[model samples]
Target: MLFGTSGIRGLYGKEVTAKLAAKVGNAMGGAGRKVILCSDTRQTSPILAGALAAGAMQSGAEVIDLGVGPTPLLAYATFVEKCDGAMITASHNPPEYNGIKLFSKGGEYSKAQEKKVEEAVSSDLKKAPWDKAGQKGRKDFSEDYIKFLIARVDSQAIGKRKIRVLIDAGNAAAYSIAPRLFEAAGCSVVRVNCDKPGQFTRNLEPKPSTLSESAALVVKEKCDFGIAFDGDGDRAIAIDEKGVVLPLDTQLAVFCSHMLSRDHNKKFVTTVEASLSVRETVERHGGRLFITPVGSLHVADEVKRQSAAFGGEPCGEYVFPFATPCAEGLLSAIMVAEIFAQRGPLSGASRGIKAHHMARTKYKCRADMKGEIMRKISEKPQLEGRLSTVDGLRYDFEDGWLLIRPSGTEPAIRLTAEAKSEKKLSEIVQRAGNLIMKEIESAH
Candidate 1:
């Protein structure tokens, strides 16, 4: 598939290349079509983005080059400009990888739209004649985006509190904008790994394991809290004042609870991978939760369909439909700051939310074997629990649940298990892993 769960992602020169980027641009570009283009901080990003712009301009589409910026910023510009957009980024992937994410004026391309792009790449794409070729221009909307975010939240409250924040942009796309947003919200901002065009000082993904340095610095610097953003600045993981990395699922629940408290809108959306804690918290707040397949695209689409207050994934990507359809990590961090202003502290945000023990592991399986393996596993069910085939096979027990799903972006099958106790969690992981291995062995 040209597009995976996210977009066309792979190694820089292998699966992802300048040729592919140009082809994708040509596929989306046409006479009189205006396309906005941008890139992340990866060394390979500029070349790919330039190639895309070249293709788009060659096809008689006016191109606006925003240069290096976050994916959310690109999406925002696309919406305001009312044009098609493309971002050259591998998102949370390592620097060695790169990809292209497509956007329509409304939101990310839907599955049907992705299929069309794939078909276009396989067919002949014509270029505009020299006389009618499109033009390329440059623009920056950073100020506008920051102003938009400040207006979305209680800037006055945040400003009055004078919240102290430590922001780690991971030296990626949001290097300049993230700190500026926090500062605009009237917060005293301390920055780390926020330098422009610098190689990633830490892991790009904003998970607990990858954010220990930022978490420790949060307490050392006596900051109110800390925020770590992914490579493309679409994911933000918060660190408590005590230098604790808040559990992903717990963080989601706290954000949802805060949103429910502020607005009368009682609808929310999340992915199937979200913890039970999220559903419970949403229900407690008198908010309804809708679950979709794993991916920000699914959550974004569901949020729009339900007119939900917002949507998010446990991995730190959040989408406020009123703000923008793409995951807005910068906005999410500011919301965290606003929460700190309204509430007491990050440590107490999840006071009443129960923490669940979760374990995750993946097994290497060729893409071609995923279908047969899933079929075999489904045919030979060994667990006597409530089975749900929403995105994959999920069995919900009274105290926990197990999910066996094929990776949409990689050649692997993943297993996620959550239980009330660590022992149960381990048992579930082992059993699920064994079951998947057995299926693989049989398929072989």
Candidate 2:
């Protein structure tokens, strides 16, 4: 029943199932009059989507099925249609897992609201009268979503440049959007792992270690840039024209620099896990930075609350308020490409920016033990240096910081560290992970 940091994600058949999905749908629908339904390429998603739609109908709320596509398309449809939206996706989780993410009418959900949806499902609310049952409808908005993005950026400028780009879909929902978007931008695109839904050919997270294929393709194709998207197509990771994998934090810094330089009044939002370099980059361009807790929902909520120009995590999920309040990999790819087109070489574009080393390590732990471990860590006197429990336990020191948070979709504790040196950051993360695991073992 834990909603984790983002939504309710779990292994298929064991944790996530049709009945549970239906219950969640009924809960959301009972609370609202209209709902939008969407799903990703996972095998179990369509079945869950059907159950969700049925439950919504039973609750007397009309269901608009957005069909299979990226999570961002669903969010955009929800925002434009003014309806509560639910996307059935585990989002970067392995093939055995799936989940559901809910958004409010404007494609944003507050923490309080997320908790309410969790509560509604747990409470088993009543369904609407049989005679007043809601109906289900179908919608195809992929092309529309692509066009919406095309209109926002300088497509003409991008098209005029002869850019070679490599795109890795990671066998997720981006397969439905990435190639088309890049082609529209006039780039010679080489696609890797672009396949039908449910065919995941690589690790779904899009992290550097899992992106060797994409990097290889970028180099082999001699592309100017390479982009990779997670399962739900909400987050992205990038490789420079030289085929060097750019860490998520560095990518965020680059994107922030581009936005801040062009739009000086823009305000950017990032999580506590973001690198100090991101704040510095934004400030250098006369823009302000707002740091929120980790999680895309939190980022999106803060974006809506503060009316910020953009929001992203160091993990590569970014939301442009002007485009859509949800993270869109296709949008990020296009934006990054446009930046490279304007700035010449990717390396030159990244020059003159202060840099920091960032690393993340995760430890396997029982979900039930997270609270106890966090409580124990909070009470340890040795760990009281510049600590903030805003979203889990975040310890911020003078030169760097570390964040220990529970994985919302997995049975693991994620430790993220950022400092000036890779060796130092890795050591910090290992030390923290070791300490937390020791605590968890002792609790048992």
Per-model TM-score, in order, reads: 0.97, 0.94
Please write out the lDDT profile of model 2 over residues 1-444, one tens digit for every residue. Answer: 557776888888888889888888888886348889988888888899999989888888899998888888888888788878899999888878998888875455666877777788778556787778889988887787889988878788788887888889877887867888888778888988886667887888887789987888788888988888888888878888777788777788888888776674578899988888888888777788888888877788788888888889988888887877777777888898789878776777777667788777787888788777878877776553487878888988777888888876678878888887777777777778778888878877
Model 1 clashing residue pairs (backbone): none
Clashing pairs in 2: none
Against the reference, the lDDT scores of all candidates come to 0.88, 0.82
lDDT of 2: 0.82
lDDT of 1 at 160: 95
lDDT of 1 by residue, 384-431 (tens): 589999999889898899888888767678888889998988888887
For residue 13, what is the lDDT in candidate 1? 93
Number of the top lDDT candidate: 1
Error of 1 at 181 (Å): 1.0
Tell me, by TM-score, which candidate is best. Answer: 1
Clashes per model (N, Cα, C within 3 A): 0, 0
